[model samples]
Target: MRITLKCLLMSCSLLIAVDASAQIPTLAKCTRSANLLACVDADGNAYSVNTVGSTIYLRGFEVIGKRYWAQTSSRYGQLTFFTGLASDGEAWVGYSRRVGWTTINRFSSSGGSSAKFTCSRIAGC
Candidate 1:
């Protein structure tokens, strides 16, 4: 009985781990072997960046992506961004194929580009 219980617990843990990894948004071509060029801000919210060697992590309390891009905040009329698009003209593009390491500013319907830095390690590069 104990062995069976242990097996079940192990299975559960494995399942949880898989789910957690999927929860975070990651780039396809952003392989660890590649070099991390840039790390963007997270929608004016809390975010952290820890880089060791060539691994850069853009961790947030409720944020996940290859990178983050911070923008104007809006409690009642502020802007924000989700996994894909920006809420009210805000976005955090961590890893992109065509653009490479870039943080596009989406302040409005016409979000301008502050900079479009490229990362050689990225897939497209």
Candidate 2:
């Protein structure tokens, strides 16, 4: 009876572990800065980001594809403002078959670059 109970508990624990693992979000690509962390999943379907005070949130309905774009103040609205300074305007993220994926700014015709000057990849930042 004791052995059976132990086996049942172990099995239950294993099942819980598997379920938890399945729910944990996978970080496919990410960019980081002193105040922010922006991550995309393997599916390119969602964005998980950190806002002020170390708060993290997920926004969705995104689809995985060759490229994805995000404009800070514009797309999501006021939420971006509270994230940090310079958290406005158009920001872009893209994926490539050969190079994997990256986040970059679109260059303007007048030599202006819509880039995040201070942010770095999560590995470095």
Candidate 3:
């Protein structure tokens, strides 16, 4: 009984860790491509992105390499964007747009680049 309980606890902890990993997003990353800055999905698909210094800004993201998406800390109270996503040698960026300010929370590494991103100007955010 004791061993089974310990195993259950360990499995539960591992599950939590997995869930934590899933929460990360990759809106930023370094790429070997041109155009100075780029964002990539975890599978290795790369997209051009705009960055300032160390942080990827709210703008400069393009979908299908055309329409650009952007956000600003001042203008929009809340915002959300894509990060690199990779799995099994495939890369893609799942996109979402949210705007409004809200509380910033801790970020995870494997959560993807945008996982460390911010959203401001939330309605109740």
Q: Number of the top candidate by lDDT?
A: 3
Instruction: Summarize candidate 1's per-residue lDDT along 1-125 as a digit string, tens digits.
Output: 11111111221111111123456643312123333323222222233333454333433222333333332221112222212233334433322222234322221123332222332324321
lDDT of model 2 at position 18? 18
In candidate 1, position 100 carries an lDDT of: 33
lDDT of 3 by residue, 1-125 (tens): 11111111221111111122566744434554332444444434333434444334332322233333332111132322333322322222322234233434222223232232333443321
Order candidates by lDDT, high to low.
3, 2, 1
Model 1 residue pairs with clashes = 41-70, 67-94, 74-78
Question: What TM-score goes with each of the models?
Answer: 0.19, 0.25, 0.21
In candidate 1, where is summed lDDT lowest over 10 consecutive residues? 7-16
> Which lDDT values do the candidates have, in the order given?
0.27, 0.29, 0.30
Model 3 weakest 10-residue run by lDDT: 8-17
